[model samples]
Target: MAYVLVLNSGSSSVKFQLVDPAGEATDAPLVSGLVEQVGEPMGAVSVTVGGQEHREELEIPTHSFGLERAFAIMGEHNVGPTDVEVIAVGHRVVHGGKLFSEPQLIVDEIESMIEDLIPLAPLHNPANLDGIRVARAMLPDIPHVAVFDTAFFNHIPPAAALYAINSEVASQYDVRRYGFHGTSHEFVSQQVPKLLDKDPATVNQITLHLGNGASAAAIRHGRPIDTSMGLTPLAGLAMGTRCGDIDPGIIFHLVRQAGMSIDEIDNLLNKQSGVKGIAGVNDFRLLRQRIEEQDQDAWLAYNIYIHQLRRFIGSYMIALGRVDAITFTAGVGENDTEVRQDALYNLDMYGIHFDKEANLVRSKEPRMISTADSPVKVFVVPTNEELAIAQKSAAVAAQARAEGLY
Candidate 1:
């Protein structure tokens, strides 16, 4: 069977999945695995195949080594390099800048373009590139495709994408809103129309992807019109360890008064802030426990999170003009019922009537959480970014084959 391997490579970890994109027999992956703590003394690789999980501890000093070990593990499951045919490898590239608006077949020139976009995604693009290079070297004959996180927001009009700064400076620097989580947003937005049994062209929805890293997007007529995250993922909702939206003056004050270096300030805002900054923890479950114990700090963090989420929802509601549905996806969005309720509370004026009972039901499948009489439907959709990447990659590879390029 032909498969598409999807890789989401991070600084110290890599998550991968093998999917038969056209498989209709089941909705499960052929194989999935993760390599964690690369470059560390103790590293681990775990794989799930045929409904069973297997793990190993090894020295994975780099992404290349980790990926090689992953391939070896897959071999044990009879999906080795010589056994199964891999048609394409799909990479989750964090930034595409203005160069790419859709999945593109990776070539040497395209690789160089991704390298040039390093400044726009300092922490993510390099790792993504590394994975691409390694995978290409390992599977030299197979086609590779890059599915960008910023591609879904490429169509957002200038009125929403451009910053109200000096036009000359902004243009020179290529500064504008380039939303992240495009795969999740696009996947969830398409699912909304199917859930409502409506034409995608007639659907206007807001999708909230709230995981450790969170963002919101306003999709009008099946296209993204605006999103909460800006040029970087750090600009949107308060994340696990990010400060989210903050005044520009705070950086200057910290530099002049607090005598903090630029790197130090960046570390503080990106690593030490958010719920972790306020409550001394980043995990939602731990924060909820602290809240149950009447910890004021955790409560405050929870309040701030819900407040920001509600603000974005309200703004997107205005942007859409007439909202049909609002979807919640990703980890926090799909599982956190309290957050869902609090975010949609007191929105009766917007025709959003929350059904508390329906919200509390825990399920992985997509379902409506709004009351029957509510004009605006609320849904919880579990995002499958890997599947989306595989589907796109398969399509690109097939198109290339039709042109005799692959």
Candidate 2:
């Protein structure tokens, strides 16, 4: 089997997945693992291969150290580096900053571009670059490709994307919407056409990826026409701990009137706000439990979240003009039954007919949740971002090989 390893490195964790070019056959796990708490207490690496689980607890001081251990353990378990030939290494690069529109094989110039994007994605791009540098150091002979998160929305038209302000100011600061979660959005958007056995040009969708960092996208004919998140992941929907869609004046007010430092405000918005600010908790599961017990704050938080989500759905519908399908993906989008029901409950006027039973069918595979009679289809699609990265990496590698770019 042709194998490729895809790595997504974050501030505190590294998620690695090995994909089979032929796809997971005969129940193979598609080899995956996580290296968590890379530089802090509770640091450890866990791997599950072919239905077996192995975990090791050790302090890792850096991305290089953790990755070295990970490769070692993969070999020890017979899913070793040498047992399978690796075609390419796909790195999930968080910010491309208009330089990279598609997955590109990593090179000196590409590394420089990633560094230049650090100021825009301080929390993510640096760690991603760390992984890339370490990968280059360790596997100098192998082909490495950078799969970007901002690449999908690079073609968003001006009307839907451009702010209604001065063009000169927008250009000076590079202030415009560059949506994140492009990998997930692209994966699901393409999946819709493939699932319906129709050409991508014929499909229109509004996809919601409701994970810790949530965002929504409006795709028309397989292109990103509009998306919820803006220049950063902190712009659109209220996420686990992110203060989304906040007033710009609030920052100035806090700094001048409340006497808070910029760093403090940043921390407050990125880390201390969102559901945690109003509800004192971020996990939707925990919040749901409190609501079941009739906790007032929990009810308030749930209400606020549902209201915001409903508003986003309506807004995106207007953007799309006519919606063929709406998809739910990622953590909350996949498993949160209550949220699905709440968001679609009263949208009948929009020609959305939901199958309550189908919506409740919780499974790993993609399945339609809307009723047969519904004009607009709704679905639950489990996202496999690693696979998406791997596919893009393989395609780019093939293209480069054909063109002798490497």
Candidate 3:
């Protein structure tokens, strides 16, 4: 009954889960919860244990405070640090740069290496590091692992990774595509082969991780050959508040003609753009509702999102040459039926016969939404990044323990 605690720490929130890596009896988590609005005047923590949910509002002025409070709540269920034997703590680090291509045990030097990558993921890495540091301090007996979001895409071909810039300049500046949401993409890639009963080394898949932030990956033979996200998470499919795939000249024009500061331009594109910029809302459900009400802006945003997503799917299909399965995951991909419908509409030419009725059914389990006769399979696979992290973390910890390092 080796337990692994997985933590995904964002700039303002932390999602935690406890799981058994073996998962022989049940795949469900032993415990899970979230701490929201850290460093704000009003913050809250929510925890679920044994199929029961609990919540509390308190002062979470820092990641440390929020995590400590969460532990306290878990204590009520007898699953806290003092009661449970946690084998490993896994932190979802957003960027690993070119230095790491897999999960690494978090040591002093490893922490420093992660810190060096802060520039690559300014918004996510720091917060991830914060959680790692706090967790290490709280539970010094167990090994902590840093699972990277960019690790899965590190194997992408050089032709796909390198920018079309000067070789020396690109190398000096470390400019290359480093995809995000890799944990989800890798998990989906592995699952697709099992779902189809195909050999992992012979499978090809196009995975869509659509949420507030969205990205796509083309997996060939269980490895990523290409992905949508670039050096940052902002380069992928249109996201909740991000202007994805915009012309670089737009930045120059904003600075020269519009007199917008660099920071202002960044904020505008990353925070105020996308569906939010177009329709004044980033929520997919709300946008769909407004579209039902015949709001033109909402309709426009929806069209733009679907168009961009379809373009990527088509390109990835070409990149893979042939596809076995096209899997969708994440918040929007799993729950938003219209999004899946619109993106795959009229793709029969590509041998994709989307089952509209099948797509309309909402379920948490992985299921197909394409006709059995279709050349390519379409599936709604819920992304369980925490489970993936837990497995990886447990493996790394077990290895370390066997090597007499833990």
Q: Provide the clashing-pair count of each candidate structure.
A: 0, 1, 0
lDDT of 2 at 303: 81
Local distance difference test, per candidate?
A: 0.92, 0.85, 0.92
Q: Candidate 1: TM-score?
A: 0.98
The 10-residue segment with the lowest total lDDT in model 1: 19-28
Q: Give candidate 3 regions above 4 Å deviation.
A: 24-26
What RMSD does model 2 have? 1.8
Q: Write the per-residue lDDT of candidate 3 for residues 151-196, one digit (tens) a residue.
A: 9999799999988989999898789999999999998788888889
Query: Which residue pairs in candidate 1 have backbone atoms (N, alpha carbon, C) closer than 3 angstroms, thus clashing?
Result: none
With a 3 Å backbone cut-off (N, CA, C), the pairs that clash in candidate 2 are 75-80
Backbone clash pairs in model 2 (N, Cα, C under 3 Å; residues 3+ apart or in different chains), count: 1
Candidate 2's C-alpha runs over 4 A off are: 24-28, 404-406
Q: Against the hidden reference, what TM-scores do the models get?
A: 0.98, 0.96, 0.97
Steric clash pairs (candidate 3): none
